[model samples]
Target: MRQLWRFGLEQAKSCIFAVVIFSALAITQFIEISFIHRYDFILIICLLTQLLMLTSKLETWDELKVICVFHLIGLALEIYKVHMGSWSYPEEAMSKVFGVPLYSGFMYASVASYLCQAWRRMDVQLMKWPPTWTVAILSAAIYFNFFTHHYIYDFRWIFKAATILLFFQTIVYFKVNQRTYKMPVVLSFALIGFFIWIAENIATFFGAWQYPGQSETWEIVHFSKISSWLLLVIVSFLIVAMLKHIKGKDNGNYV
Candidate 1:
């Protein structure tokens, strides 16, 4: 147990700024729950814990790009989705619980960081980008999506996949070398997408929420497989393009 706590503490050191921000919000949420509203206390606690996790500094510089782009694309996509009533989560959670509204940012923080840690557990080097083999494996993963639970509920998987390819093509123009495809760096974003996909599937399957069943077909797993590639590719852009720009290290920052 001591070892576990130590490991966890080491992990939470990167996003201290995010944690501080979220903890402040969490206190407000706590007050709202205790004095004003009768909400899901369990879910609120989960949200608070996630926010606390932001105090952890993540040194995955490569993943900075993944977080930046995924947050933009996922936020855009989620806004559109919520607008369309494609699905919904409780809206009263004060926009800060990692589920609806701005808590989405917390969810975004979890993506690349979670993936980086998980990939380290895999103990293998990731293949270089734009290589024939990488493309081949990515293609196979795409194929796997179409046959699974992902597409059954959300076609956004298609959008995710397309963005990944675009991100990769953009990277190709830079002539990125083999070492750029480091394992944790690439997996940082990929794992986040996968977790979102998995959570959505589990929730829908259990009737936590339901997408309109009137859709013409329900192709979940097989549908989302290939689109998974977009995540890794998009991360490349986030690290290679977005973060550099954000940090004033790129030509695009001025624009």
Candidate 2:
């Protein structure tokens, strides 16, 4: 019983930031402020939330750096995606740059924050982690595909195959209470991707962003998006793994 309580507590610790961000989004959907754009308000709330986390020691400096990097990465992708007509931000904001709001980057950073917090709180470890270079190459290919698919053939399935080849044997070890739990790394990616897809639906419902099809009315995001999120989860996982130096052997064993 005590162990379960500790497990729940640690899970909450890991999720608190994401919960707060989602809560803020949910609440802001109903709020009307004539003086300020909703996007700018979200940006302010996100920045303040981040500062509060840092000041309270809920997040460490190293994790902050990782989160910041994701923010930039996400912002770059947002700019390109928005330009490519992949998604649309309907609201106006002073914080907008090339039609991408600053707060949009925080959405990506939130993923990093969640992984970092969970890694530390749950004492995660990797087993048979694929070589960094291999994953890096895969990540680059996946990212490039997002942009090139519009002009060229969509080779996402091929990229997904390569990712499976590279990470199929990898395993992740995390703790629940005093006990350690293990899962295939690929499975972890799929699980996180699934949840992120769900969150994307919720976010879209709240008007965080919209697909071309959603310009007139909100609809459930296509289930096919889970594949994209799976690839992204790998990218985020690699970043966190690199930062933590949790490399493992090629065989399904920890070094």
Candidate 3:
């Protein structure tokens, strides 16, 4: 029981960036501001929150770089998806480009931030990790599928099968308190994806963005979105894992 409590504490700690961003979303929902658009306000808040995390030493410079990479990657996806009518940012904002608020990228960055913080705080390591080339190819395929699916036949299921086959032997070991715990890498992806799905519901409820179905009235995001999030989480994990591997190899401590 105590170990579970400690684990939860660490997970919450790892979500500091996400929590702050969500809080800003929730708070801005009720307050009216005339000077700045709500999306722009949220963007400013996110920027300040990130600056605080950096200045307080909660996030390192290298980790910030990784988070920035995710931001650009996410922004690109957001632009394409919105163009494809996947979803939309309805409100007007100075920071919007091609109908996506610039702040939207930070949402994706928050996911990377969580992974980076959790990996650090919980002393995470991977076992039976696949080769770099295979992982890179898989990551690229998964990412591009998010775009190409709109034009061509969606290969998500095939990619999902590939992910399972590739990482079937992989295990994640994370430390909690004085005890270390292990779980299958696939299971971790599913769990994180589930929570992110729940967060999506909350974000929509607060009017962060809207699906066509939600434009009339807010409703639960389709549960099927979990699979999408699962795939995304896998890509996020693979990127972070590869970075860890490279760093570890340099430091003579490859996991």
Candidate 4:
């Protein structure tokens, strides 16, 4: 029970960035400020949060680089998805480009931040990680599918299957207190995706963005979105894992 409590504490610590962002979403939802657009205000809040984390040593420079990469990747997707009418930012914001608020990218960055912080806090390691080439190809395919699905037949289920086949033998090891725990890599992806889905519900309730059905009357986000988050979480995890692998190799402590 003690280890479980410690594990929860570490997870919460790792989620500081996301928590702050969510808090901003909730606060801005009800508050009225004439000088700054809500989206821009949220963006400023995100930037300040990032700076604070960096200055406080809660996030390293290297991890920030990774977060930046995810931010760009996510922003590009947001632009395309909004264009395709997948979802939208209904509010007016000066920082919007092609109808997507710039702050939307930070939503994705928060996921990367959590993964990096949790990896460090829990002393995470991987076992039987797949080859670099295979992982890279899969990651590219998963990302590509996100865009192509709007035009072509969706291959998400196929990619999910591929992910399972590729990582079925792999395990994730994380420490809590004095003991280490192991989980199937695929299961971890599903669990993280589930939690993100819950967060999405909260964000939508707070008016972060609106799905087509949510524009008029807010309802529970479709459960199918969980599969999408699962795939996205897989990509995020693989990128972070590869970075860790490369760093481990450099330090002669390959994970």
* lDDT tens per residue, model 4, 75-106: 99999999999999999999999999999999
The lDDT leader among the candidates is: 4
C-alpha lDDT of residue 21 in model 2: 71
Off by over 4 Å in 4: none
- Candidate 3: count the clashes: 0
The residue pairs that clash in candidate 2, if any, are none
Clashes of each: 37, 0, 0, 0
> What TM-score would every model get versus the actual structure?
0.40, 0.92, 0.99, 0.99
- State the C-alpha lDDT per candidate: 0.43, 0.86, 0.94, 0.96
lDDT of 2 by residue, 194-242 (tens): 9999999999998899999999889999999998898788889887887
Candidates 2 and 3 compared: the better one by TM-score is 3
Alpha carbon lDDT at 147, candidate 4: 98
- Which model, 2 or 3, shows the larger lDDT? 3
Candidate 3 residues 1-255, lDDT tens each? 999999999999999999988898999899888899999999999999999999999999989999999999999999999998999999999999999999999999999999999999999989999999999999999999999988899999999999989999999999999688999998999999999999999999999999999999999999999999999998998998999899999999987
TM-score, candidate 3, is 0.99
The local lDDT score (0 to 100) that residue 50 gets in candidate 4 is 96
TM-score winner between 2 and 4, please give it: 4
- Which regions of candidate 2 deviate over 4 angstroms? 1-9, 246-255
lDDT, residue 240, candidate 4: 94
